[model samples]
Target: MSDQSLLRERWLPGVRELSFGGDYNPEQWPREVWAQDLDLMRRAGVNLVSIGIFSWGLLEPRPGEFDFGWLDEVIEGLHAAGIRVDLGTPTTVPPQWFWQQNPHVRPVMRDGTVLAPGSRGICCPSSPEYAEASLRITTQLAERYGKHPAVALWHVHNEYGAPVSECYCEVSAAAFRAWLQARYGTLDALNTAWGTTFWGQTYGDWSQVGAPAQSASMSNPAHRLDFARFSSDELLGCFTRERDVLHEMSPGVPVTTNFMATNCPSMDLWKWSREVDVVANDHYLTAADPRSQVGLALDADLTRSLADGRPWMLMEHSSSAVNWQPRNLAKRPGELARNSLSHLARGADAILFFQWRASRRGAEKFHSAMLPHAGENSRVFREVTELGATLWSLTDVLSSRVQAPVAILWDWESLWAQDLDWRPSVDLEPRRQVREYYERLWHDKVTVDFAHPTADLSRYAVVLAPASYLLTGEAAANLTAYVEAGGHLVVGPFSGVVDQDDAVHPGGWNGVLRDLLQVSVEEVLPLPENAGVTLTGGTRAGVWAEDLAPQDAETVLEYTDGPAAGRPAVTRRALGGGTATYVSTVLDHHALTAVLDPVLERAGVTIDRDLPWDLEIVSRHGADGSEYVFAINHAGAPVDLPVEGVDLLTGEPCTGSTKIPAGAVRVFRR
Candidate 1:
């Protein structure tokens, strides 16, 4: 076989169907139940399962002592039952023995409280002892099961920055200093970048630097931002360490670590995605939000974009209510299928959950799983099996890519910078801004992909920057070139306010984008709570407003009330071949939709105007020139979708109109 084919074979073995399964923890149950579990998995059309994620303590009960007999039996049973394995290194949870040996490796909080090892993901990323222990376990696992017939993929670790991301321990401090030296090369450059001269906190020696630990007052924003970067890199370094070992021992098998893409703000996925062979993500619905379905779509689209349009994996999601939320809400009837299909609609080749069977005890015992506590006869398990069968039938959609004409700028550094203290308003939430704009477009029936600010925008007809607090000079030049090349750009308020180092642009607000936008912000006006300002277009905005000065741009909507009355609340600048529109205040959803309608029309971006508000439509194109349209109805009543194809879910012919039941999903091959 060719090298590529050999690698594919090693990753997938003989599997030619879409992967369907969840994390299987047979160690939690007795040996008698293992056979029954395999039988049920076969009945559910499960072909792949992640094994040994939290098995560090179980795999090695004592230091250097191994217990692999049970694991070997489980793997043998899975292969005999025609199941593949996504073997995990189990490094996320270190054994108690190892923790006892290296107690100092425990992560320290900013207030100097050393975190105990009762929970998962409690180790410091920069600790050399933890690194050594993790690699030791990883090497043992890879050497044992690297060429195992059932092992298809290597799962390096669990969520990297969940319970703990940054550590204020002394080890982390020294590592942070080293990272700064490599990045800045000298203390002079570091001082200039951090702007430490203002508070008389400039460092003369590298030893004086710390991990932005607890201070008497607020720490420097630049220091905190770089520390966030360093922490993320530290976690990534831990992952690559194990991944390299796996690659060496299991030459052709693919390695990946699940990402909490939208959920975890610590890791920068735009950078992390480049390191993984297959990008996988774990997403859970926020029960508090009534429109969490919109958030789900947003997360799925972002995950797909992180994979660069390649088919990614839904590594973990709840079949019902999750245990961590303040008030866990159970999934309604058909909601499970709807959620899974929504992810599949957005280019997810594999549909998996956190676990196969619900745990009987532990902190996450209450967390929902494929097989709930109520067992296989329950609604959750029935829905899971039904979805599995549906996925099995829709194998043609595997490897298809979701195509989008619009792109949204997603920058983690900008988010981290904006999250710092003492911004214009604490209500200026970056994620909320992006989601509201995404929700508007979702309602407009527009499929969107996320792009880095500095990425090529020529492929997208319309590029939107809903929240870009930190816009670098290179990114600014890229945006200018994209606009000059005839691409429409829409920027939200409070953007271009800072550069990469969390420092304001040289001249004033809206730094590098001022020329391209043809406007400048004289000052930022943060309104009080519950207070709103009016615009000429009958739109009300609150929380944030800018004193905008239009140089050559035409005033689309001028403020009619409040501090900046009569100033341009919204402006449009005609550039070389296209136009750049800027919204100087946070507009309500209705107003945002109204504003984007004309922009969409001018850009020639088509929208499903006749589609129902609760119905979502997205298309994925196969390599063989086939198109699959997924229509998901989140409402409580049936809706008629106009499409010409055969429904893969029911295998029925729909000439033009298909009647989709309430809270149902339909995939049509067009």
Candidate 2:
């Protein structure tokens, strides 16, 4: 079968319309309340519910004993009510009894402090004891409900590595050593790769290496990077172990685990995406930053890219305000619909929240849900049902994919290595730099897809790799070939300087991409706080500057001030049928546009120039050969779009210059 057909068949087989629901923890309530939940779900158009996510303690109250009686009732009740289930593995939180029986399963932090079990996700991933218990519970879950007509997907452990990711226990240290040995093969190779000679810290034996924890001074960068990699891999190992149990016991049941936002350092979702049948994510708004909702849209876009154009799930989000933030502000009217539709516009086939009902007693008691503390008569419930009806009305858009001619590269390892200790500047964050460009694209109404550096670039006309500090040889080769094949490539500063092992390349800066970008770096000048450089076109470069000279490329932007005055700040080169542009300075929004606008135009990318500042537009092609345009007004003021289309929400024909109220989402069918 073709890859597309195979993906649909394997990940989300026979899913019609967008599945709408939230986590249903029936265990939290009495058996009498379950019937009410099902009735409420029906009213809300919720056909799918995630169950038993954190019910390990209830499933196995004591070791060597199992109880499936209560769970059976829950599943049977949901099925009787016509709701399919995404059965959770319940491995994220072990029973308190299991941890008390085996104290060694607890994780130790970097400061050698053992994390006492007062919260969820506290077990050490590297501990075999924890793995064994996880396998046992997962096996029993699969055996009991794998073939049940109610189950649709196997939901693996909840949010892997959320609270405690890296464990500095002895077991984890030994595991790290074993991982390094397998990666480097020999001690000499590991020493060279880590540059161990610099600090008189050479290791002659594998046992000498331990988790990079609690160093007297700044830790070794390579050691920290490797430890980060190992920690992510260890968590992934935990996921795959549970997944294998489900796959063996329930052959056709697709499996997935919820991934957090992209900026998380613990688990690499890109690598983890390959292991799961479907990609699912949980995102909550940054309450501290008022303007962070746009960042939330970016997170959804990145998650869609991780799914590779296939429909994924928005596994968890808040119906209103989240309790965990410092000051949880409830979402305003229409914010719920706007947020849910935004995910659907970005390739999510399902919109699910963290909870079906609000908790009466727990750490998350105040967290909003489909049914809030105020009950069915509340505003939250009204909006929940409204959003569900809208989803049910758009069944024709099911399985539709978001297409983008522009691709932006995001790398986990580069993010890990770039902001490590002793860097040129503390502000060399990979995400912040990429967002500068991503935000501009959003402002200009340009659609973009997030990609790995090694992803196939043939389908895209423009590719942007910003803050790619560490480049593997394979990734470098892939991008080089992409430019050679008539694709326009834009690279941010500090890219291609180091290899995968955090070792600086021998050739002058931009390492493998030196010739392709046709520029060589002589020196780097990190601007002090509150200092910046003046550039042409009224553009200002803040935080970073590189003394660059063009070899075979032409200088596009020149640094007119700062220590690297009169040097090339931006350079471009044309090679075999394509072009490559490099930006050497951290440009403000205006400066970024001055450099990127021309590149987008040259690549034939379409940007709605007349789009309002507060409005964002996304287009998706429906499975039934129709087109969907989501015009979302994110600002507090209304926006008037001078376009004509049918309003899918109201079924009214909209003509030129339609006004969308503040924080409203208008779905247009063209």
Instruction: Identify the candidate with maximal TM-score.
Output: 1
Stretches of model 2 off by over 4 angstroms after superposition: 1-11, 642-645, 655-657
Find the candidate with the highest lDDT and give its number.
1
Candidate 2: TM-score?
Answer: 0.97
* Candidate 2 lDDT by residue in tens digits, 608-669: 76767668888889667778888888888988887677887888898877888998988888
Candidate 1 lDDT tens digits, 88-200: 99999999998889998999988888999989988999888888888888999999999998998889889999889999988999999999999999899999999999889
lDDT of 2 at 305: 88
Which portions of model 1 show Cα errors greater than 4 Å? 1-14
Give every collision pair in model 2.
none
After TM-score superposition, what is the CA distance of residue 655 in candidate 1 from its true location, in Å? 0.9
Residue 321 lDDT (model 1): 91
